[model samples]
Target: MELTKEQLAFFDTFGFIKLSGLLKADITWITEEFEAVFPMLEEKHDGSKRTMIVPFADQREKLCSLVDDPRIAGIAKSLLGDDFNYMGSDGNYYTGDTGWHRDGENRARRHVKIALYLDALDGSSGALRVIPGSHRLDDKFGVDVKRVSQSQTALHVAGPDVPAVALDVVPGDVLVFDHNLFHASFGGSTHRRMFTLNLCERFGEDALDELRAYILLHAHFKREHYYGSAMLRSAGPERRVHLEQVDALCGDYAERTKDLPELPLKALI
Candidate 1:
């Protein structure tokens, strides 16, 4: 469904929204796909730390098609325009707590993450928590949180101690949030199932440098291409609209990079 006027406004104002049961029909297959994808990877999650896979949705053709699902596409199209770029995705089995944090440093560009949690969750069970309106970089709340929490020494407290709304969700629900939004999850079991699809506004010719930098980040994934052959092979026109931009520059992404940025200390899924 296309977002209504108020829905758009809420995302713009609060930086996140939860759409319950939007993926209910596909949940069963999504569950199968999630289970199927992990064994392809050599890494095993022993409940010690977060286990992650990049280009997550592409691992299974069914999961890759989620980008074309009307409800999923609508959310991305509504905020990012018809020509949005499909940035990438991540799948995870999270262990312990995820400290409060923002996902990116680009202030001029905006991106949104569509998160799917495959298990029932609450604040104390790894439900996503967010500080509303925190994406407004220049605002007082945004600046203050960034200042105090960037080092965490000034706050001198744990992430869950900070005030915020804990978003409760079930298996079929979906959560969308601005990449700049301050969010975290805590008090969870060792194995929390989750995955995300990321989308962002199309860059203008003048912003190609920024676009290149964003594409370069795929280096950390240890990948030579952004999307998998499955995503590209199955993409129809609408999906192609989102995939074309990234495909232009990712052909030899890994070989081109002299060094990859250090992986995140804590894996974010």
Candidate 2:
């Protein structure tokens, strides 16, 4: 449950990293589960008649469970101490516009936010945008509330011209970043846009096993559909995924780090 020197360096400079296919099934389950509840939340429509803002808390625990993945939980433990709380949890939809903003607090103490993508994405497809190295700046520079329709900039920084990562998540991939890093996302491919959040009050362990298994299953499911076959890989010329074994394939991720820091066990949101 430790981060390598490279990962620490990347996080220190870039403010984020893109791990493709990190949590597939968990991603899909959360997305599908939230979409089912999206209609119940207050929907603000845009010019195209699509929901602009649909933040609901009815089933936040379900989505939050996806964030508590042990692997990701491990990352949090490695960076932040093992004493924190799940600050908040909910789902956000951006079929239209999302203003630029930071998820960090304005206080002197530092904090971070981790986002998990539920599907594939690219820069043009309303992918999550981030400002590299911005997390090191002061809280004011780290957080801005100007609220641009598509652009994300804090109070002092120039309009978000920073190199933003596309976050082409393959279902299981998770994006761990500092809240101070400016970020935004918009509509893309008519596909569902979903991600989970793990904001800390201090920092602690996460449910890596449950989280990792969910992601893997999600990716496995998608591959089966895309290739028009089932099986992680077939025994024939065109390898196919055997869907039957997918459910049984969730990895054996027992919580091994008893020494890891302990966070508030309260449910997210």
lDDT of 2 at 93: 48
By TM-score, who's the top model here?
A: 1
Q: How does candidate 2 fare on TM-score?
A: 0.57
Name model 2 segments beyond 4 Å from true.
Answer: 42-61, 105-107, 139-163, 186-192, 201-269
lDDT of 1 by residue, 121-210 (tens): 999898999989988888887888784354357776767777889999988999999998999888888999999999998888788777
Which pairs of residues collide in model 1?
none
**Residue-pair clashes per candidate:** 0, 28
| Per-residue accuracy of model 2 over 1-269 as CA lDDT, tens digit each | 55777988898777787655556656656667766655543433233423311122224445434334566656766666443333333344435435456664334334566665555676666667776766765545443322332343333333334445556555667778887666766556444455445444331125444433433432311121211111122223211111222223233311322333222121111
Shift in Å, residue 229, candidate 2? 40
Residue 244 lDDT (model 1): 83
TM-score of each: 0.92, 0.57
